[model samples]
Target chain A: MSQTMPDWSVLAATCPSRTSLARIANKWTAMAVSVLGGGRTRFGDLKARLDGISGKVLTETLRDLERDGLVTRHVFAEVPPRVEYELTELGFTLHEPLLALCRWAEEHIAEVLVNRESYDAR
Target chain B: MSQTMPDWSVLAATCPSRTSLARIANKWTAMAVSVLGGGRTRFGDLKARLDGISGKVLTETLRDLERDGLVTRHVFAEVPPRVEYELTELGFTLHEPLLALCRWAEEHIAEVLVNRESYDAR
Candidate 1:
Protein backbone atom coordinates (compact mmCIF):
# COMPACT_ATOMS: atom_id res chain seq x y z
CA MET A 1 0.00 0.00 0.00
CA SER A 2 1.08 3.61 -0.49
CA GLN A 3 2.54 5.08 2.66
CA THR A 4 0.06 7.80 3.43
CA MET A 5 0.61 9.40 6.78
CA PRO A 6 -2.42 11.04 8.33
CA ASP A 7 -1.87 14.69 7.43
CA TRP A 8 -1.01 14.32 3.66
CA SER A 9 -1.35 12.06 0.67
CA VAL A 10 -0.68 12.01 -3.11
CA LEU A 11 -0.99 8.24 -3.41
CA ALA A 12 -4.50 7.80 -4.69
CA ALA A 13 -5.23 6.73 -8.23
CA THR A 14 -7.97 9.26 -9.02
CA CYS A 15 -7.60 12.16 -6.65
CA PRO A 16 -8.55 15.71 -7.63
CA SER A 17 -5.74 16.78 -5.36
CA ARG A 18 -3.25 15.46 -7.87
CA THR A 19 -4.85 17.79 -10.39
CA SER A 20 -4.47 20.68 -7.98
CA LEU A 21 -0.76 19.90 -7.66
CA ALA A 22 -0.29 20.55 -11.37
CA ARG A 23 -1.63 24.05 -10.82
CA ILE A 24 0.85 25.39 -8.26
CA ALA A 25 4.02 23.62 -9.31
CA ASN A 26 5.30 24.74 -12.66
CA LYS A 27 8.38 26.58 -13.94
CA TRP A 28 6.43 29.61 -15.04
CA THR A 29 4.28 29.67 -11.92
CA ALA A 30 7.31 29.36 -9.65
CA MET A 31 9.21 32.09 -11.45
CA ALA A 32 6.24 34.41 -11.76
CA VAL A 33 5.22 33.98 -8.14
CA SER A 34 8.78 34.49 -6.91
CA VAL A 35 8.93 37.72 -8.87
CA LEU A 36 5.50 38.69 -7.59
CA GLY A 37 6.35 37.73 -4.02
CA GLY A 38 8.02 41.06 -3.53
CA GLY A 39 4.83 42.82 -4.70
CA ARG A 40 2.43 43.17 -7.62
CA THR A 41 3.14 44.82 -10.96
CA ARG A 42 1.62 45.28 -14.40
CA PHE A 43 1.61 42.52 -17.02
CA GLY A 44 4.32 44.08 -19.19
CA ASP A 45 6.45 44.90 -16.17
CA LEU A 46 6.06 41.45 -14.67
CA LYS A 47 6.93 39.93 -18.04
CA ALA A 48 10.13 41.95 -18.16
CA ARG A 49 11.10 40.72 -14.72
CA LEU A 50 10.93 37.00 -15.56
CA ASP A 51 13.72 37.04 -18.21
CA GLY A 52 12.91 34.30 -20.78
CA ILE A 53 9.13 34.06 -20.65
CA SER A 54 7.16 34.69 -23.81
CA GLY A 55 4.26 37.14 -23.61
CA LYS A 56 1.83 34.32 -24.37
CA VAL A 57 3.20 32.13 -21.57
CA LEU A 58 3.21 34.96 -19.04
CA THR A 59 -0.48 35.54 -19.72
CA GLU A 60 -1.34 31.90 -19.33
CA THR A 61 0.60 31.56 -16.07
CA LEU A 62 -1.05 34.64 -14.61
CA ARG A 63 -4.40 33.30 -15.69
CA ASP A 64 -3.68 30.02 -13.95
CA LEU A 65 -2.63 31.80 -10.78
CA GLU A 66 -5.74 33.92 -10.87
CA ARG A 67 -7.96 30.91 -11.38
CA ASP A 68 -6.36 29.20 -8.42
CA GLY A 69 -7.25 32.29 -6.36
CA LEU A 70 -3.63 32.89 -5.53
CA VAL A 71 -3.54 36.06 -7.58
CA THR A 72 -5.86 39.00 -8.06
CA ARG A 73 -6.15 40.95 -11.29
CA HIS A 74 -7.20 44.58 -11.18
CA VAL A 75 -8.16 46.60 -14.22
CA PHE A 76 -8.06 50.34 -13.69
CA ALA A 77 -10.36 51.94 -16.25
CA GLU A 78 -8.05 54.63 -17.51
CA VAL A 79 -6.63 55.92 -20.79
CA PRO A 80 -4.68 52.79 -21.59
CA PRO A 81 -6.82 50.60 -19.29
CA ARG A 82 -4.22 50.09 -16.62
CA VAL A 83 -4.05 46.52 -15.26
CA GLU A 84 -2.09 45.10 -12.37
CA TYR A 85 -1.51 41.61 -10.94
CA GLU A 86 -0.79 40.88 -7.34
CA LEU A 87 -0.76 37.86 -5.06
CA THR A 88 -3.70 37.36 -2.77
CA GLU A 89 -3.11 36.36 0.85
CA LEU A 90 -3.36 32.79 -0.38
CA GLY A 91 -0.73 33.35 -3.01
CA PHE A 92 1.60 34.91 -0.47
CA THR A 93 1.71 31.58 1.36
CA LEU A 94 3.76 30.15 -1.48
CA HIS A 95 6.60 32.60 -1.08
CA GLU A 96 8.61 30.89 1.64
CA PRO A 97 8.21 27.30 0.42
CA LEU A 98 8.96 28.29 -3.14
CA LEU A 99 11.94 30.29 -1.96
CA ALA A 100 13.19 27.26 -0.07
CA LEU A 101 13.25 25.24 -3.28
CA CYS A 102 14.86 28.10 -5.20
CA ARG A 103 17.47 28.48 -2.52
CA TRP A 104 18.06 24.75 -2.66
CA ALA A 105 18.51 24.97 -6.40
CA GLU A 106 20.93 27.88 -6.08
CA GLU A 107 22.91 26.47 -3.17
CA HIS A 108 23.19 22.84 -4.24
CA ILE A 109 23.37 23.21 -8.00
CA ALA A 110 27.04 22.29 -8.17
CA GLU A 111 26.49 19.10 -6.26
CA VAL A 112 23.55 18.23 -8.49
CA LEU A 113 25.68 18.85 -11.58
CA VAL A 114 28.49 16.67 -10.30
CA ASN A 115 26.01 13.95 -9.50
CA ARG A 116 24.47 14.27 -12.93
CA GLU A 117 27.88 13.86 -14.53
CA SER A 118 28.56 10.84 -12.40
CA TYR A 119 25.22 9.29 -13.35
CA ASP A 120 25.81 10.04 -17.00
CA ALA A 121 29.23 8.44 -16.80
CA ARG A 122 27.65 5.25 -15.51
CA MET B 1 14.15 47.23 -16.00
CA SER B 2 13.46 43.91 -14.27
CA GLN B 3 12.51 44.23 -10.63
CA THR B 4 15.32 42.33 -8.99
CA MET B 5 15.26 43.03 -5.31
CA PRO B 6 18.37 42.34 -3.23
CA ASP B 7 18.13 38.62 -2.41
CA TRP B 8 16.21 36.54 -4.99
CA SER B 9 15.89 36.84 -8.72
CA VAL B 10 14.51 34.59 -11.46
CA LEU B 11 15.05 37.81 -13.40
CA ALA B 12 18.33 37.22 -15.18
CA ALA B 13 18.61 35.77 -18.67
CA THR B 14 22.03 34.18 -18.61
CA CYS B 15 22.07 32.74 -15.14
CA PRO B 16 23.15 29.15 -14.47
CA SER B 17 20.53 29.32 -11.75
CA ARG B 18 17.90 29.44 -14.45
CA THR B 19 19.16 26.05 -15.58
CA SER B 20 18.95 24.87 -11.98
CA LEU B 21 15.29 25.84 -11.75
CA ALA B 22 14.30 23.30 -14.38
CA ARG B 23 15.99 20.52 -12.47
CA ILE B 24 14.01 20.97 -9.27
CA ALA B 25 10.55 21.87 -10.52
CA ASN B 26 9.22 18.85 -12.37
CA LYS B 27 5.93 17.03 -11.80
CA TRP B 28 7.49 13.63 -11.39
CA THR B 29 10.14 14.88 -9.01
CA ALA B 30 7.50 16.42 -6.78
CA MET B 31 5.44 13.25 -6.76
CA ALA B 32 8.34 10.95 -6.07
CA VAL B 33 9.61 13.11 -3.26
CA SER B 34 6.18 13.27 -1.68
CA VAL B 35 5.85 9.50 -1.75
CA LEU B 36 9.36 8.89 -0.52
CA GLY B 37 8.96 11.52 2.17
CA GLY B 38 7.45 8.92 4.44
CA GLY B 39 10.36 6.45 4.29
CA ARG B 40 12.31 4.03 2.12
CA THR B 41 10.90 1.14 0.12
CA ARG B 42 11.69 -1.38 -2.61
CA PHE B 43 11.11 -0.66 -6.29
CA GLY B 44 8.03 -2.82 -6.49
CA ASP B 45 6.58 -1.27 -3.39
CA LEU B 46 7.15 2.30 -4.49
CA LYS B 47 5.73 1.64 -7.93
CA ALA B 48 2.73 -0.06 -6.43
CA ARG B 49 2.36 2.76 -3.92
CA LEU B 50 2.22 5.66 -6.35
CA ASP B 51 -1.04 4.51 -8.01
CA GLY B 52 -0.65 5.73 -11.61
CA ILE B 53 3.06 5.85 -12.41
CA SER B 54 4.58 3.69 -15.12
CA GLY B 55 7.56 1.61 -14.06
CA LYS B 56 9.82 3.34 -16.57
CA VAL B 57 8.73 6.78 -15.37
CA LEU B 58 9.36 5.86 -11.74
CA THR B 59 12.88 4.68 -12.57
CA GLU B 60 13.70 7.91 -14.33
CA THR B 61 12.36 10.04 -11.47
CA LEU B 62 14.27 8.04 -8.84
CA ARG B 63 17.42 8.30 -10.93
CA ASP B 64 16.94 12.04 -11.17
CA LEU B 65 16.45 12.31 -7.42
CA GLU B 66 19.57 10.25 -6.82
CA ARG B 67 21.59 12.39 -9.19
CA ASP B 68 20.36 15.43 -7.30
CA GLY B 69 21.63 13.88 -4.00
CA LEU B 70 18.15 13.73 -2.50
CA VAL B 71 17.75 9.97 -2.70
CA THR B 72 20.01 7.00 -2.17
CA ARG B 73 19.66 3.59 -3.76
CA HIS B 74 21.06 0.44 -2.20
CA VAL B 75 21.53 -2.99 -3.66
CA PHE B 76 21.98 -6.04 -1.48
CA ALA B 77 23.78 -8.73 -3.39
CA GLU B 78 21.96 -11.67 -1.89
CA VAL B 79 20.50 -14.72 -3.66
CA PRO B 80 18.12 -12.68 -5.82
CA PRO B 81 19.54 -9.20 -5.12
CA ARG B 82 17.28 -6.71 -3.38
CA VAL B 83 17.13 -2.98 -4.02
CA GLU B 84 15.90 -0.20 -1.73
CA TYR B 85 15.54 3.56 -1.91
CA GLU B 86 15.75 6.07 0.92
CA LEU B 87 15.84 9.83 1.30
CA THR B 88 18.99 11.73 2.26
CA GLU B 89 19.07 14.58 4.76
CA LEU B 90 18.49 16.96 1.88
CA GLY B 91 15.51 14.89 0.87
CA PHE B 92 14.15 15.20 4.38
CA THR B 93 14.27 18.97 3.95
CA LEU B 94 11.75 18.59 1.14
CA HIS B 95 9.28 16.73 3.32
CA GLU B 96 7.86 19.75 5.07
CA PRO B 97 7.63 22.07 2.08
CA LEU B 98 6.39 19.31 -0.13
CA LEU B 99 3.78 18.37 2.43
CA ALA B 100 2.70 21.95 2.65
CA LEU B 101 2.05 22.01 -1.09
CA CYS B 102 0.25 18.69 -0.97
CA ARG B 103 -1.94 19.89 1.87
CA TRP B 104 -2.71 23.05 0.02
CA ALA B 105 -3.66 20.99 -2.99
CA GLU B 106 -6.06 18.93 -0.93
CA GLU B 107 -7.67 21.78 0.94
CA HIS B 108 -7.99 24.15 -1.98
CA ILE B 109 -8.73 21.79 -4.84
CA ALA B 110 -12.46 22.55 -4.78
CA GLU B 111 -11.82 26.26 -4.99
CA VAL B 112 -9.28 25.72 -7.75
CA LEU B 113 -11.75 23.67 -9.74
CA VAL B 114 -14.41 26.34 -9.35
CA ASN B 115 -11.94 28.93 -10.58
CA ARG B 116 -10.95 26.74 -13.52
CA GLU B 117 -14.52 26.29 -14.59
CA SER B 118 -15.14 30.02 -14.30
CA TYR B 119 -12.02 30.82 -16.28
CA ASP B 120 -12.94 28.30 -18.95
CA ALA B 121 -16.47 29.57 -19.31
CA ARG B 122 -15.20 33.06 -20.08
Candidate 2:
Protein backbone atom coordinates (compact mmCIF):
# COMPACT_ATOMS: atom_id res chain seq x y z
CA MET A 1 0.00 0.00 0.00
CA SER A 2 2.82 2.39 0.89
CA GLN A 3 5.08 1.33 -1.95
CA THR A 4 3.62 3.78 -4.44
CA MET A 5 5.76 6.77 -3.67
CA PRO A 6 8.26 8.27 -6.10
CA ASP A 7 11.13 8.11 -3.61
CA TRP A 8 10.64 4.42 -2.79
CA SER A 9 13.53 3.52 -5.02
CA VAL A 10 15.78 5.90 -3.17
CA LEU A 11 15.66 3.72 -0.07
CA ALA A 12 15.59 0.46 -2.00
CA ALA A 13 18.37 1.58 -4.26
CA THR A 14 20.63 3.61 -2.00
CA CYS A 15 19.04 3.10 1.41
CA PRO A 16 16.74 6.11 1.80
CA SER A 17 17.80 5.99 5.37
CA ARG A 18 21.05 7.46 4.11
CA THR A 19 19.57 10.93 4.30
CA SER A 20 18.58 10.86 7.98
CA LEU A 21 21.00 8.04 8.64
CA ALA A 22 23.76 10.58 8.82
CA ARG A 23 22.01 12.21 11.73
CA ILE A 24 22.07 9.12 13.92
CA ALA A 25 25.00 7.45 12.18
CA ASN A 26 27.11 10.56 12.45
CA LYS A 27 29.92 10.59 15.01
CA TRP A 28 28.22 12.90 17.45
CA THR A 29 24.63 12.00 16.66
CA ALA A 30 25.18 8.31 17.16
CA MET A 31 26.87 8.74 20.50
CA ALA A 32 24.43 11.35 21.64
CA VAL A 33 21.43 9.29 20.59
CA SER A 34 22.87 6.17 22.11
CA VAL A 35 23.36 7.97 25.37
CA LEU A 36 19.85 9.30 25.21
CA GLY A 37 18.52 5.86 24.38
CA GLY A 38 19.45 4.70 27.84
CA GLY A 39 16.95 7.30 29.07
CA ARG A 40 16.42 11.01 28.98
CA THR A 41 19.79 12.70 29.32
CA ARG A 42 20.88 16.23 29.97
CA PHE A 43 22.90 18.10 27.41
CA GLY A 44 25.93 18.39 29.63
CA ASP A 45 25.92 14.67 30.37
CA LEU A 46 25.63 13.92 26.70
CA LYS A 47 28.57 16.16 26.01
CA ALA A 48 30.60 14.35 28.61
CA ARG A 49 29.63 10.90 27.31
CA LEU A 50 30.54 11.81 23.78
CA ASP A 51 34.07 13.08 24.00
CA GLY A 52 35.38 15.78 21.65
CA ILE A 53 32.04 16.98 20.22
CA SER A 54 31.93 20.75 20.09
CA GLY A 55 29.08 22.52 21.84
CA LYS A 56 28.06 24.08 18.54
CA VAL A 57 27.79 20.79 16.66
CA LEU A 58 26.10 19.04 19.55
CA THR A 59 23.49 21.75 19.83
CA GLU A 60 23.01 21.74 16.07
CA THR A 61 22.60 17.98 15.77
CA LEU A 62 20.23 17.89 18.71
CA ARG A 63 18.18 20.63 17.17
CA ASP A 64 18.11 18.76 13.88
CA LEU A 65 17.06 15.56 15.58
CA GLU A 66 14.36 17.38 17.42
CA ARG A 67 13.19 18.96 14.21
CA ASP A 68 13.09 15.60 12.47
CA GLY A 69 11.00 14.13 15.30
CA LEU A 70 13.66 11.61 16.17
CA VAL A 71 14.40 13.19 19.49
CA THR A 72 12.26 15.04 22.00
CA ARG A 73 13.63 17.91 24.00
CA HIS A 74 12.37 18.77 27.44
CA VAL A 75 13.17 21.93 29.24
CA PHE A 76 12.70 22.15 32.99
CA ALA A 77 11.94 25.39 34.72
CA GLU A 78 14.81 25.68 37.09
CA VAL A 79 17.99 27.55 37.73
CA PRO A 80 20.31 27.29 34.72
CA PRO A 81 17.24 25.96 32.82
CA ARG A 82 17.72 22.19 32.86
CA VAL A 83 17.19 20.48 29.50
CA GLU A 84 16.92 16.85 28.50
CA TYR A 85 16.65 14.80 25.31
CA GLU A 86 15.21 11.39 24.55
CA LEU A 87 14.39 9.32 21.51
CA THR A 88 10.92 9.29 20.06
CA GLU A 89 9.18 6.05 19.12
CA LEU A 90 10.37 6.33 15.56
CA GLY A 91 13.90 6.92 16.69
CA PHE A 92 13.71 3.94 19.02
CA THR A 93 12.74 1.69 16.13
CA LEU A 94 16.13 2.38 14.61
CA HIS A 95 17.88 0.74 17.54
CA GLU A 96 18.43 -2.75 16.20
CA PRO A 97 19.55 -1.71 12.73
CA LEU A 98 21.80 0.99 14.06
CA LEU A 99 23.29 -1.40 16.61
CA ALA A 100 23.82 -4.02 13.92
CA LEU A 101 25.58 -1.52 11.69
CA CYS A 102 27.79 -0.52 14.58
CA ARG A 103 28.66 -4.10 15.43
CA TRP A 104 29.38 -4.81 11.78
CA ALA A 105 31.63 -1.79 11.60
CA GLU A 106 33.46 -2.73 14.76
CA GLU A 107 33.88 -6.33 13.66
CA HIS A 108 35.01 -5.37 10.20
CA ILE A 109 37.17 -2.38 11.09
CA ALA A 110 40.44 -4.25 10.51
CA GLU A 111 39.26 -5.54 7.15
CA VAL A 112 37.89 -2.14 6.14
CA LEU A 113 41.17 -0.50 7.14
CA VAL A 114 43.13 -3.11 5.25
CA ASN A 115 40.90 -2.59 2.27
CA ARG A 116 41.36 1.16 2.57
CA GLU A 117 45.14 0.73 2.51
CA SER A 118 45.02 -1.57 -0.47
CA TYR A 119 42.66 0.78 -2.22
CA ASP A 120 44.89 3.77 -1.53
CA ALA A 121 47.93 1.99 -2.99
CA ARG A 122 46.05 1.40 -6.21
CA MET B 1 39.83 -7.05 19.26
CA SER B 2 39.24 -4.38 16.61
CA GLN B 3 37.25 -2.05 18.86
CA THR B 4 40.26 -0.01 19.94
CA MET B 5 40.16 2.91 17.56
CA PRO B 6 38.82 6.35 18.46
CA ASP B 7 36.48 6.21 15.50
CA TRP B 8 35.01 2.91 16.63
CA SER B 9 32.19 4.75 18.33
CA VAL B 10 31.39 6.57 15.14
CA LEU B 11 30.06 3.38 13.59
CA ALA B 12 28.64 2.22 16.90
CA ALA B 13 27.24 5.63 17.64
CA THR B 14 26.12 6.81 14.22
CA CYS B 15 27.15 4.06 11.76
CA PRO B 16 30.61 4.27 10.25
CA SER B 17 29.17 3.02 7.01
CA ARG B 18 27.55 6.48 6.80
CA THR B 19 30.63 7.73 4.96
CA SER B 20 30.84 5.13 2.20
CA LEU B 21 27.18 4.48 2.75
CA ALA B 22 26.44 7.79 1.11
CA ARG B 23 28.49 6.77 -1.90
CA ILE B 24 26.51 3.60 -2.46
CA ALA B 25 23.32 4.85 -0.85
CA ASN B 26 22.99 7.90 -3.06
CA LYS B 27 20.30 7.95 -5.74
CA TRP B 28 22.73 7.52 -8.60
CA THR B 29 25.25 5.38 -6.77
CA ALA B 30 22.64 2.91 -5.54
CA MET B 31 21.03 2.41 -8.91
CA ALA B 32 24.34 2.40 -10.69
CA VAL B 33 25.92 -0.06 -8.30
CA SER B 34 22.83 -2.25 -8.38
CA VAL B 35 22.88 -2.37 -12.17
CA LEU B 36 26.62 -3.01 -12.17
CA GLY B 37 26.11 -5.77 -9.61
CA GLY B 38 24.22 -7.84 -12.15
CA GLY B 39 27.43 -7.91 -14.18
CA ARG B 40 29.79 -5.54 -15.88
CA THR B 41 27.71 -2.80 -17.51
CA ARG B 42 28.57 -0.10 -19.96
CA PHE B 43 28.18 3.50 -18.84
CA GLY B 44 25.38 4.25 -21.28
CA ASP B 45 23.56 1.07 -20.28
CA LEU B 46 23.76 2.03 -16.63
CA LYS B 47 22.53 5.48 -17.44
CA ALA B 48 19.56 3.94 -19.15
CA ARG B 49 18.75 1.57 -16.29
CA LEU B 50 18.84 4.46 -13.83
CA ASP B 51 16.51 7.12 -15.10
CA GLY B 52 17.12 10.86 -14.42
CA ILE B 53 20.81 10.55 -13.56
CA SER B 54 22.82 13.14 -15.44
CA GLY B 55 25.90 12.10 -17.36
CA LYS B 56 28.03 14.31 -15.14
CA VAL B 57 26.85 12.79 -11.81
CA LEU B 58 27.02 9.26 -13.11
CA THR B 59 30.58 9.72 -14.28
CA GLU B 60 31.52 11.35 -11.02
CA THR B 61 29.99 8.57 -8.88
CA LEU B 62 31.60 5.86 -10.96
CA ARG B 63 34.92 7.60 -10.55
CA ASP B 64 34.41 7.87 -6.80
CA LEU B 65 33.47 4.19 -6.55
CA GLU B 66 36.57 3.26 -8.49
CA ARG B 67 38.73 5.48 -6.34
CA ASP B 68 37.31 3.88 -3.19
CA GLY B 69 37.86 0.38 -4.63
CA LEU B 70 34.16 -0.40 -4.46
CA VAL B 71 33.82 -0.77 -8.20
CA THR B 72 36.19 -1.68 -10.97
CA ARG B 73 36.22 0.02 -14.35
CA HIS B 74 37.22 -1.76 -17.52
CA VAL B 75 38.04 -0.07 -20.81
CA PHE B 76 38.01 -2.08 -23.98
CA ALA B 77 40.22 -1.29 -26.92
CA GLU B 78 37.76 -0.70 -29.70
CA VAL B 79 36.76 1.94 -32.21
CA PRO B 80 34.04 3.16 -29.87
CA PRO B 81 36.26 2.72 -26.81
CA ARG B 82 33.87 0.58 -24.83
CA VAL B 83 33.93 0.97 -21.02
CA GLU B 84 32.34 -1.12 -18.25
CA TYR B 85 31.87 -0.98 -14.48
CA GLU B 86 31.30 -3.71 -11.89
CA LEU B 87 31.39 -4.09 -8.13
CA THR B 88 34.50 -5.27 -6.35
CA GLU B 89 34.40 -7.88 -3.59
CA LEU B 90 34.03 -5.27 -0.88
CA GLY B 91 31.25 -3.61 -2.76
CA PHE B 92 29.51 -6.93 -3.13
CA THR B 93 29.63 -7.42 0.63
CA LEU B 94 27.31 -4.46 0.95
CA HIS B 95 24.62 -6.26 -1.06
CA GLU B 96 22.65 -7.71 1.83
CA PRO B 97 22.69 -4.57 3.93
CA LEU B 98 21.95 -2.32 1.01
CA LEU B 99 19.10 -4.52 -0.14
CA ALA B 100 17.72 -4.66 3.37
CA LEU B 101 17.86 -0.91 3.67
CA CYS B 102 16.10 -0.46 0.35
CA ARG B 103 13.41 -2.99 1.20
CA TRP B 104 12.86 -1.38 4.55
CA ALA B 105 12.59 2.02 2.93
CA GLU B 106 10.11 0.78 0.38
CA GLU B 107 8.08 -1.05 2.97
CA HIS B 108 8.06 1.71 5.54
CA ILE B 109 7.93 4.61 3.13
CA ALA B 110 4.32 5.48 3.88
CA GLU B 111 4.96 5.53 7.56
CA VAL B 112 8.05 7.62 7.05
CA LEU B 113 6.11 10.01 4.88
CA VAL B 114 3.30 10.17 7.39
CA ASN B 115 5.83 10.82 10.07
CA ARG B 116 7.38 13.49 7.94
CA GLU B 117 4.06 15.21 7.51
CA SER B 118 3.39 15.07 11.19
CA TYR B 119 6.84 16.38 11.89
CA ASP B 120 6.47 19.20 9.42
CA ALA B 121 3.20 20.23 10.95
CA ARG B 122 4.89 20.55 14.30
Name the candidate that leads on TM-score. Answer: 1
TM-score of 2: 0.67
What TM-score fits each model? 0.83, 0.67
lDDT tens string, model 2, B79-119? 88999888889778655654554455455555665666787
lDDT assessment of candidate 2:
0.65
User: What is model 2's native contact fraction?
Assistant: 0.13
Docking class of 2: acceptable
Residue A22 in candidate 1, Cα distance off native in Å: 1.3
Instruction: For model 2 chain A, give the 10-residue run with minimal summed lDDT.
Output: A10-19
Give the TM-score of chain B in candidate 2: 0.75
Clashing pairs in 1: none
DockQ (Cα-based) for each candidate = 0.49, 0.24
- Candidate 1: residue B2 lDDT (0-100): 96
After superposition, which runs of candidate 1 have C-alpha atoms over 4 Å from their true positions?
A1-9, B1-9, B78-81
Per-residue lDDT of candidate 1, residues A48-120 (tens digit): 8888789998898888788878899999999888889999888888877776667766666666668778877
